[model samples]
Target chain A: MNIFASLSRKPWIWSFVAAFVVWIATILFTGGTSAIGLSQAALTFAAFSILVGIGQMFVITLGPGNIDLCVPATMTLAGTIALKFMQVDNSLILPGLVVAVAIGAVVGMGNFALIKLLQIPPIIATLSMSFIVQSTAIWTNRGLRIKPPQALAKFTTETTIGIPHVALVALVLSVFAFILLQKTVYGRWIAAIGQSNRAARMAGIPVDGTRFVTYILCAVLAAFCGYLLASFSGGAALNMGSEYLLMSIAVVVIGGTAVAGGNSNVAGIWGASLFMFLVVSMLNTYGAGAGIRLIMTGLIIIAVIVAAGGRNPNQR
Target chain B: MKRALPSDSIRLLIPALSLTILLIAVFYLQPRAMSYVGLNLLFNLAVPIALATIAQMLIMTVNDLDLSMGTFVSFVACVAATFLQATPVIGVLILVAAIATYAALGVLIHVRTLPSIVVTLGMSFVWGGLAVLILPAPGGHAPEWARAVMISRPPLVPMAIIACVVIAMVAHFVIMRSSIGVILRGVGGNARSVERAGWSILGARAATYALAAFFAILAGISLVGLTTSADANIALRYTLLSIAGVILGGGEFTGGRVSPIGAVIGALTLTLAGSFLSFLRISPDWQIGAQGAILIVVLGLRLLLNRLENREKRS
Candidate 1:
């Protein structure tokens, strides 16, 4: 009873409910005759949402009024590097994944260094980084598409017992992330750092190193998700990762994670992801094109954020 | 007679240096492209972006950023096109109406004290949708007379360049002299302080938004004439470019100082950069990459400079 009451009081709960209602309405009105394909699509969207949401959650965990703007570029660069490597040699799939993760780590480290060294605000630094990443990706691709290898594609496509393979990957990643964030000493430190960074440093926590690692981990997760997305679609495009930017932020907000940091709810994110997928599906069924879909998504996010209020009234 | 550097004078130099470097590079590379006609093209191109950059700077001054300025420009342009394709007079009216509508929307958003990032983003989508609904495929031209007046070259100098100079001068005067201008700078520097001083922060923010929307409309008008047609993607580039210009011009995210002349110089620099890239016959992909790279470098430099300045102050 206490758990239920506590969950109910969460600001994200209302958004989750709203998203669920919209999703159910979409499924019912659309008539789920093509259940297999729809289910596959829903699963894939849900999985990617979790991956991106986790990245957002990590940044929020640092608190100190921080947000990352380089998420889309980070995801794109990860996927692009993975695809480029896979193209060069068919056997380099695992190695390519490692390279992508390394790239994400470097990006994370660079972001942390810039923020700490120059006193550039986190948002501005991340934003500038995003531009650099996007520009670099465009230059590398040379207006051409890079397709993933057959085996990687199969991994994303092949279903186990009717569920999509990508969906399974998302589930595994989420569970791992949930455990790491909840049961680990690192998780406790994240909570502490978010609540009060100065105090955490005084308490002997490696605040800078911890922040650096969390951002890198976030980027790595996003990269992994990007690889899945690229593999699923068979290739990557210039603007392929742009859609995920807002979606990631929306999921985190909807999942009962305070934007100000120090607190998070994985279950809430999971629920929100599910609801968001349904809403998108419904909007698609109603004959809404990409432009309208984007508009509706933006409006919905704003509405949710407004309901949650800005940056928690109590936090300084 | 030696005089101390006015606070605004140093602010103006940043853009001047950027513009000078860009122009020198262009002229050095392709003197042929520096014709009167080319100069006109540069000025025309800079107008919309300059207006939009000023708009972005205005909101940013209050510690808010509008990611939707581009979409608003597209919306106004498309709506005006729908009405003006047949009658240019009606098109001007439609443009005015669209601007007024967006301004009202901006006021409402400010009243709610909602995060401008999300609100403007959502508004961008709404405006983009409306634009697409009005012109699904981006056809329908502006009147020849409208285009002629906009694109015309004067005997001594390009009319477009003259118009830009005039606008910059007027904006500089108003920014330095107006009561609202002073309040805007105060609010940008510290909104909480102003609110505590018993000023209506909401009203000030709304007025700033109104000013931004007004400039967005002017940008739209210039853009519609330049392309001679309306398209959904027209506004997308301006959003990022405007931010780049504002930051390049030394406009802080927190409001206190404004440099309209600085923004113009930033706009000119951007225009020259684009022209220089084109003269080199670089692929469109490389041009975009270059733009992004330049912005990042500038921002990094700005941060480094600020840090050095802070250290100097402490010492």
Candidate 2:
């Protein structure tokens, strides 16, 4: 009964337990110091996914089949734009971040417009937008390599109390996200909209407005993640942002947020992101090739999704 | 008022109109494109895309999205390049097993009441992994017979154009003009109703998924044939392109309303657009963006037309 109660209260328990087991195994095989290094690396990278998962959590909570598929493209475009604008000067960092944010907001608006004005499905609408964004990124850059500024790179990579600075930022963001979702009226409105749009509209919950805002916010988060990743890597590549697209969705769903909406798991997202990262790290520790890792990740995603689908909110 | 074109005709009209516009643009940009040789070159890569689009259309007809179509095709290509070249019987068995897996996927989706998007998205990774494991890199030869068939040319027309016509006609007849087609579409339109009408919903879904797999298999084999090589990453773009093609061809996400004819034409339009941009000497980087822009503009126009039609009806 105690176990059941805990599981009910914390949907993220499954992921945490899974991650812990994997971490132990990794430590057993790779020694204590290397395990710590893997943990630090995973935690640092998990920050990017946590940011993406938050925005995706909001959108997925918007109702069944409501997803933003343009995240990777948006991130790639943002990174490209940031690299082009940041230059070599340290003073340009703030302006570059602002530019990335603004571009994300605009792209989000475009996604909203496509979904609302044209009544195109969310998946297709975002996908088409992503393609357009990809094109713009590619055409403008042609695979140009511009190193990130010193300040931004330091901000992303530097450690504080053995935790990467970005991880600390992500921690604060997750807390804020948790409070927003669990305590705010706006969060309630989003939850209502997700459960049933028609009912929410009948109850005067401003369904479309909330959904529009959610999509924009998700894009903004993705854009920020792209910027951070570009800085962390010291440069951007054409396909730099591709992996985040699926990773974000996988984190959200595996974090126990119902894919059919009506539920938001802010805390769960943090744990799930860490779990996914650890899975990758563990595979790497075992010297598993990319193909084996790919297969394992795919199988894990399917298994988790299948398990969650059993009690999905959308099912009658 | 007496004769506004029927809605079905209007549905078919859009793709025709867009294809013509694209052809004219291509010809105007490069007069040499009007020749058979030029067209052969322009549309040489379109066959695989058209076949993949048709595969997507089949899945759409059953109200399921196969997000793995692109990677699954690549997996098939890998098998074609390796096993088909070295061991013909093994290659045939592997391809058949892959199709069976697709059929099993449909059953699993139905039984588990799982979202097709998530399931297929996960499967895309699996297929990609398999592809990587099989090829490990970007070098493999297609079977000799497959290469011969792909390279074959006849008088007065490009092989690609002729093949497109034949494939479209065959798909249309099977999926739109036959009894089983009606049943399949019925399953998509209303599964409960189809079940009530004594049709097996699960069976229809399995059949559609199997047919989709079959088409994707063809797409992969032909892709290998054309390129005479296979890579784990080849055909990755087909996932989005096929979905876009289906929608541009007037297919919807909900209902079983898809058009093989329109899908083939949509693929042709997109292929031509890409070739046309290349002919204009635009950077390869911009080619994808240009293709996307065309999809948006065409879909936007279709939406505008829909509004007008609705307004006219009300008046």
Candidate 3:
């Protein structure tokens, strides 16, 4: 009864219901004609969306001001770094992953420092940092494309049984992140600080450090997703990360995570990710190109935000 | 009795200093870059963005963002270009109609009390899509007379500079003298308090957004003149640039304060910066990176100055 009540209380459950309806509509319309192909596409997009959503959730649940504009750039920079490293030496695959994650951490730390030291508003600071990171990525790439490494490519493509590799990776990461957020002391601190930094500080929580770590963790995860993205897309482009910005925020909102921080629903986030993918896939299947797809996506996000209310209770 | 300078006065001074420093840097680096012709070009480039930034600043002062300004601008430009291809008068009518329609939409969203960011962003996408539909490949041209009027300079000074000054003065008047302006600042500072005072938050927000759309339309027309042709992609850069300008000009995104003149000056600074980079023959990619870097640095410096001022006052 308690579990059911909790599930019912989850805001993202409503989003999931919406997603399920769309999934059913998609399946009915397609009539199993391209079931395997549809599933593959859906899985890949869902995984990518989930990873990005997870990163957003962390920042939304942490930060003095509950907003993050650096997710896309951080992800892109990480991907760019990973790709560049892999291109130079095939033996540096593991090192490349570490370096990519580290780059994300550095970017997050940079934002954290700015917010803490300079007292720049969170949204503005993150936004400016995002621009910087994006520019850096563009500059590093020298207005050219960087191909994905072969080993990483194989890892992302190789699947076991019926499940896709990307989906599996997403699942593992989500579960791990969920556990980290729910069961750990740091998780409790995150929630506490998010609720009231003053109270958290009174309770002896390292508020600034926690926020810094949260941002770093978020950036690292986003970067990891970017790596996965590069592997899937086979190459990294300059504006590759920009698309993820809105999608990630939308997923977080749909997943029942408020932008103001404190509350989070990992399961709901995963469901939202799946729902977003299903919607996009359905739209694409119906012959909607990039422009239409973008418009529809924007509309759906707006609708969801309206339904959820303008201010998230958890937001600072 | 001793009194500290008003916040507004300090706000004005910062932008003035920033602009002066920017001009000095440009002149020092390249002495010949300060020609009348070059200044005219800079004014032309800054005017549209300055108008858009003013619009953005109004919304931001109310603690709202208008992400759709660029798209709205593009849509209006496309409409004006298509309907007024041969007649400048028709183009003016189309522009007014477009602005009115967008303002009505703004009112609708405000009345609903929806999140401005999400609503405007969605609206922008819809408008952008419509623009693409209107001019699929960007071949249609604005009437030659209209274009000439938009880009032409007066005998004594550039028309663009005059437009900037006139618009800034009008905006300053509207923001400082009007009851609606006071109400906007009040609402931006604290909506709950304003509501408690029996004021309609929606009314204030709607008016600001409508004003923003009006400016956006004017900007769109100017952009059409600059490019000669209506392209769907023309206004995309304006979205970020306007916000950057507003912030750099000491306009807070969360409602309460605005500096229209500051915003214009910020726009001018951005234009000058871009031109200076172009003069150095920097690639497009490098230019973007440099612009981003400069904005971040400027914002950082602004924050540092604000902190110091606050501390000094406290002391």
Candidate with best lDDT: 2
Candidate 2 regions exceeding 4 Å error are A6-11, A31-33, A139-142, A311-316, B3-6
* lDDT sort, best first: 2, 3, 1
For candidate 3, write residues A101-216 as lDDT tens digits.
88988888888887787676777678778877887887788756777767778878877887889999999988988898899988888888778778899999998888888878
| Predicted complex 1: CAPRI docking category | acceptable
Cα TM-score per model: 0.87, 0.94, 0.91
For TM-score, the strongest prediction is 2
CAPRI quality level assigned to candidate 3 from its DockQ score = acceptable
DockQ of 1: 0.33
Query: What is the model-wide C-alpha lDDT for candidate 3?
Result: 0.77
Error of 1 at B86 (Å): 3.6
Q: What is the TM-score of chain B alone in each candidate?
A: 0.88, 0.96, 0.90
Between candidates 1 and 3, the TM-score winner:
3
Q: What are the per-residue Cα lDDT tens digits for candidate 2 across A62-120?
A: 88768888898888889878978988679999899998998899999999998888777
Q: Please, what are the lDDT tens digits per residue for candidate 1 over residues B1-315? A: 336466578667656766776777777887765888767766678888888888787777677778788888887677555676677687677666665665665565555555566567657767777777778898767656657767777797887788778768866766667887877778878878988988887778777777887888778777787888988777886876777677677776555666777776677777777787787787776675566556555556666665665576577
Over the stretch B19-99, how does candidate 2's per-residue lDDT look in tens digits? 888888889988988998898888888999999999999999988888899899999999999998999999999999999
Model 1 CA lDDT for position A57: 87
